[model samples]
Target: MSSVIGKRCVCRVEVSRVEWNFLHPWQRTPQSKSTGTAFVIEGKKLLTNAHVVRSATDIRIRPHGSTRRYPAEVLYFGPDFDLALLKIKGEQEEIDFFAENGKDHICSSGKEPDAKRKKFLHGLQFATDLPALHESVHVVGFPTGGNTICVTEGVVSRIDFLGFSKSLMLTIQIDAAINPGNSGGPALNSEGLVTGVAFSTKSHKKNQPLSNIGYLIPIDIVKNFLGRCQENPSTYALSPIIPYRFHSLENKSLRLAHAVPDTVEGVLLTSVCDSMKGFLAKGDVLTGIDDRKVSNDGQVQLRGDETIQHGYLLRGKFLDEQVRFSVFRNGEHVISSPAVLRYIPTICPRWESVDYFPDYLILGTVVLLPMSTYLQCQKGCGTRLSASTTNWCQKWPHEWEGKEGLVVLTEMFSHEVCFGYNRPYWRFVETYNDIPIKCLAHLRDLWEESMEQAKESDDRNGDSNSAKTFSFVRLGLEHSDDIVFEVRAAIQAQADILKQQHIPCPSNITQSNPRYKS
Candidate 1:
């Protein structure tokens, strides 16, 4: 309790709009407002989560005691770290009031003190070394209702190998009471040092009682954020690849899409950074890298020639430099190619651009604009039901066979239109109203047409018809029944039970959808 009582720190945050694709036919562009905390770091810089400022067209920050919000500027951000450095004048003066005085010794320094009172500062320090299992800790954050910071004490219950992100730090865990408003808050050790920043929460079992299991983005990632801030402030590392010799593509046509290599494939030149020495080359048909076998499809796998899938390879490649490749060209096997590490942004092909989706929603479903990469990722396996098409067929490599758009990652039931079909992260949108969805333009056109039809029905029926009308939605499939059924059903049952009691419903339904398509 002592760790919590004094751990509270005041943070002033303002809401900003995050642009997302509208899955519906009626809505052309939609923006969601998200709140984020503003904290002073390194005197001149303000720190917040990259997500706080992601896709923001407008940004403002308010000091803890101020009524007038001041415009703030982003200095640097890294998608990998989910960390952003914001800039505003008078930052030092803004936080000077909370700075500890000379006589205020916040540190216990291992000395046993009175149990009744404990001291903490505005921001805690991260222990360079990780805490042991069951170690005591606390989290300080500015929770939802108001800006007054709150502290919740808990323990380091467990840590697991969560997959990596753009910044590529290994995943970690803590059992602190971190909620939606607690994100970007600091996790602290007994000494009041920051261990990590709260990012997400998880529940271990389905239909099971749960606790405050939170995931923190490790503090060590600050190094990468700092570097990007100084060198490339405009762009964050969206998806950086440390390239090895690409051997050959099983389907040379799908070389970019499949990223697979074969015995007869030509290597990609990738990047040529003069500063990066002894690590890369242009002609290496990569066979293996850092002991990971390089598949012909440009896939890096673990031992026994297993296929290393997803962005996980990006994680391993982040920590190491050189990779050994087994390349065969003209019947010659060469085991060499310096790894090339380069930052490559995720390109939303013009055809698949979010703008193409209908300005609104329809039939409680959102459609996906077919991008070359998305279709390529699909390997042209699923049937195309949407009516739209694109030039991606020409530009995208042959290996894709004719697929587009990466599978949907998530979907949240934000409003009434998506009530019963509130499935999130279930399946990718393959078609819309029987139309073969090809590109963003196609999806958009389909949505507009659907909206017109819905409007016409409303005029004839003399009913508002607004309840079922949708705005643009990010298209994705529903979670697998087995994966989401228990939790969703429990939530539904709970809602019904609460309705019987005349009690208000929970504002936010906290659940993680695990069934994500590629």
Candidate 2:
């Protein structure tokens, strides 16, 4: 492999982000700095890990062996695939300088060529096929404890669905030393072709003692991200997943109960999303996807003895494309026409706004925020609230069909009006005055409407001298709890509570009503 590949192609990324404090719910830590690696791709874009630039307030990129830093912005980000595309921003002269100097024209010794210069940098080409088992590969990146590009050699150890970014996707496991700054670096094959992008590694456990188990985002996923970016240049279009639980048909009793024949080898569908509720019932068994036959263990055979999770068939195809499925229903082989792949919004999104502050609403003393993976990480799971939130995040409940978003009471400020509500934070607000809380914006609207109603009621009663009372009913541990307070007194105390707590605003209601002021 030519050493100029690393010096001319690989680049270092610097990011500055504001870390939010989930516990305080109102405090934001100072600007935090992080670094990673990226490489130039086709179309004058840079490819890197989504996590590397997540929550970034400012991003700058410096080409290998260059001190000049150029500002960049995220063009597209796919959290599921953990891939992001960035575009460099600056004057034409600065852009042309990096574009010209960062090409593969420079020699390995970091010297400019004495002959004529090449017009374009030789971008790494992706491997046409998946890397074979034990295939030699090289990882190049700017790892920690160094400012220059580093290279590590390894082989493809395994390929399977690995859990990452709160979901499972196809990943290539390599025996490479992947460190902090090595993320988003390209893993090249023996021919110096890009095979994968280094992303994560398994942590060493005292009992497990796992080592040399770094994972890479495979080229298929990278291609999918790039393809989606080409289709939609402004944002990412993630592949739609068929929300269904599959169980192996190896159980004899289960097969007999479903009237499945011994010859039929396919996985049983235990449950499906609301959209597929009618088309595919619980007892239906998925026999095949497209032309691929699904085995009893939910595995699909690819070319030349490669068997992977059947879900990969759907992943490989584009969104809205029809995929034919062979199913066995009522002990008879049935060929379903085709189901169009589409994205279904989860009840709780894994990553909400990647480059901005978490959206929150503060009404009175309650700090309400959306239920997300970030919040779940901050507030450890296993508690009643956390467990319930996690469950909701995994499976969208039929009861929450019309609701736009799930807002949880993350924290509460101590105030005279909210004294007895010591039921702990992270609880989901069922309703406000018997009206279902659709989302954070709806919750804010409900509170403001309730206050207005209370003021009107005070006027109608001809009790101009009496204080207005506002009632807020919430779901409690055993039953419903009524939280009643005087509107004027609560409003007066809210301002003081926000100032004392150093909260920037009472609530972030810009999404719904931009004109709303604290």
Candidate 3:
């Protein structure tokens, strides 16, 4: 197939972004410029990798060989699958964007091809089915070498692969020349139909990055994502989560502990998903799912000969779908039943939140907010979370005591009341005034109650030695001593502390605040 079709539908994405600074929630990181690729899709929309436009402030799209740069906006972004759907900011029913009429596309010559001899592609079409191993493919994008659309040929080296966030998505591995600027481009097959989207490669790895080994969001997952996106435009539409977390029963000792026999070949349940509430337990060993036998290494055969992780078998399963499982529980071969799939989130919240602005709380010189998954996502985005606390933020969904979050004292500064106490930076606030602190909202409530008590109980009292006259708040922490401060002094310094720090408000207790919904 000619590269002309690719040049017609594909585009050069120019993004300028001012990324957020997790440590300094009030400020954004410096602006930066990057280029990638995208292709025209249905309904006047474009599709590209989510990371390409992440935190983007200004976005422009330049069609191949064209001087016009059209402004675009993100319609929907899916960080889990590394995809984003975009639409031109202006121009409704603008057919000229993809026009083949007297337009010089990809050809440097200032002449358009003869009308009867030319062809135009309205949009890139999905391949009817995925390509096979050793199938030749083309990668079209504006990579680092030059701005022109570069086409590289490669073969489908492997299939049914997974990457990033342990996403368990069906991916494609190719031996292609994928570079920095090639991200978000289309991977087309022999018939010029897009088989996948070139999203990432191994060259960005820290230790020993290599070239010629790139990955693609296979058509299977691509179609699945688009199918859901079509149901609800401009929303982070999601399918139901794979309803199980299994650990390999490869260790004989571990298997014996679960009272499993040598004849049994299955994976141990690290934690049962809440979606399967009463049907399964944490210690139960899963022998099979959907009637397919799982090996001790937690693999199941798919597509006849292809063997993939047990989780892959659950891919693309949407809401209300029944998942039958064969289980081993309580020293017997029991617990075989099906459970309906539901949208249950992991213990940690997803990073693709609609809330772009993070919430913050200021108490005197100390700054606080709830710990979130951002601690993990932005690898180099600096934060004060300790190693153990950071690890706990990555847990799967499970039953836990108390509330579901940790109120972290992220920042501490010099102040009269904060002088003698140990700096409680990044430590979980376990209690306030002998009352358990559940979340930032709860902490705000307790602060209000403490202030009301001070005003009514002791502002008029003459005896400073009375217990009621002790206007101080004690905050207990995990693995640290209590942080005690005089409530009156903190209140007096609150205005100055906030003013000097340039903080917007004393407390933005929830991420769901409509003010930060954008």
Candidate 4:
């Protein structure tokens, strides 16, 4: 039976991760241990949720009913999809034995087979079609209570787009109880085929407890993620957002204003991104995508019985691929040209690369860091600084594409040189030496240049008593109150300040830095 196959396929995964402290930016928190479930897929690979192994320093897997632990390496991870594929390391013989026997072999000599033995491992098959609502399904995994494989029966309650890990993706809501440790487990259909991967559950509100609200990454999304990996094995391509706000054109007044025909049913584009600035104008009616007719409510019929968001048609599309659209523009039905999909850089990047150290720079007592969603969350979200910075963070990348980067003055360590400045943390850096700052790396370059120029000027004058100085403008500060500092004095004091503060380095250079290449 497929249920029996699931029991043999499900495995327990343990991850040891070292999380970074956003407050300090460079320092890391103590190592932490977390457990989740994974199941074998094609190619002898284990599939699991990305969050299960986020920031993981080491990953180990124990197959069902096996006491032996095998090391595994992440081959592919998609933060947006919350999926990760792992290839087990150096346990081919043990894995093969377990695959054939469904348990660890107890040899007479109490010794496992050596490299001479060869065996085959089996993987679970995925359903070719989407599961229907109310279809019987089984949730298999090692839940929080114990390490034993557990199975629960349920029905597919609903299938829709739900927010997971800060991004909206297609999900299947099941009535089964999906608790901690169940993440990355497989949800199998009646035939024992994989329907989706168990992921998130809705939390209960105060005074009200929610039930049977677990969500799974739908099979289509899983397939899309796998296909993307196969296409580009070297680089991870992020899925693009629609880049437009949609509104229903069911109202007669809006329909008449846009000149949409009565026979046409479509949604009105309220706003568009800068990339689509001229090609697709606001107030244009989107009637269809790839020849699929869209409903007034921004939905399209995916199949005979399934109607999904019109955006679903754009899923798994590469950045270079173009999508055809039918639109009502200027009171006429037009077949619009193919528009290529592209990903926009966001202020808050996904936490997929949590293992990486944050890029930061320290000058004298002031700590300069780039503004990110992670940083905003670490600091109070409701604070005046957070609120003000969030507005700019939400702005599309195209709005400031020319700018190299956006950075903020995050912290100020007390020093005699910066005595009366009363540094405002979270204030955006507008300019350095009256020149508009590009990015964090560019800011560092400007600082280096300013210091060198100041030194040259002092040398040209041959004035040993004169001090070398540089100045910068803060976004909210007045021009007359520019923050100024003596470059030579600050440089002299940097070593002492860093030692006193127990800082390992003055800055963590990023790949984007030109110095990194050199």
Best by TM-score: 2
TM-score of 4: 0.87
Clashes in candidate 3: how many? 0
* Candidate ordering by TM-score (highest first): 2, 4, 3, 1
Q: Across residues 308-417, which tens digit of lDDT does each residue of candidate 3 receive?
A: 77776666665566888788877677645667777665434556344333656677677776666345434532444556455664454464346666676766877776
TM-score of decoy 1: 0.48
TM-score of each: 0.48, 0.89, 0.86, 0.87
The residue ranges of model 3 lying beyond 4 angstroms of the native Cα positions read 100-120, 203-208, 256-263, 328-338, 355-357, 373-387, 394-398, 422-424, 455-468, 510-518
> Candidate 3 has what TM-score?
0.86
Residue-by-residue lDDT tens digits, candidate 1, 275-312 = 23443444444454455554555554332433333234
Count of backbone clashes, every candidate in sequence = 66, 0, 0, 1
Q: Lowest summed-lDDT stretch of 10 residues in model 1?
A: 509-518
Stretches of candidate 1 off by over 4 Å are 1-10, 18-21, 24-33, 57-70, 89-126, 145-147, 163-169, 203-209, 239-337, 343-368, 371-398, 401-518
Candidate that scores best on lDDT: 2
Error of 3 at 339 (Å): 2.2
Residue 73 shift from truth in candidate 1, angstroms:
3.2
Give me the displacement of residue 308 in model 4, in angstroms.
2.9
Which digits, one per residue and each the tens of the lDDT, describe model 4 over residues 113-202? 442222213577899877899998888888899878888889999888667776778888889999889999999898778999998888
User: Candidate 3, residue 470: CA error in Å?
Assistant: 3.1
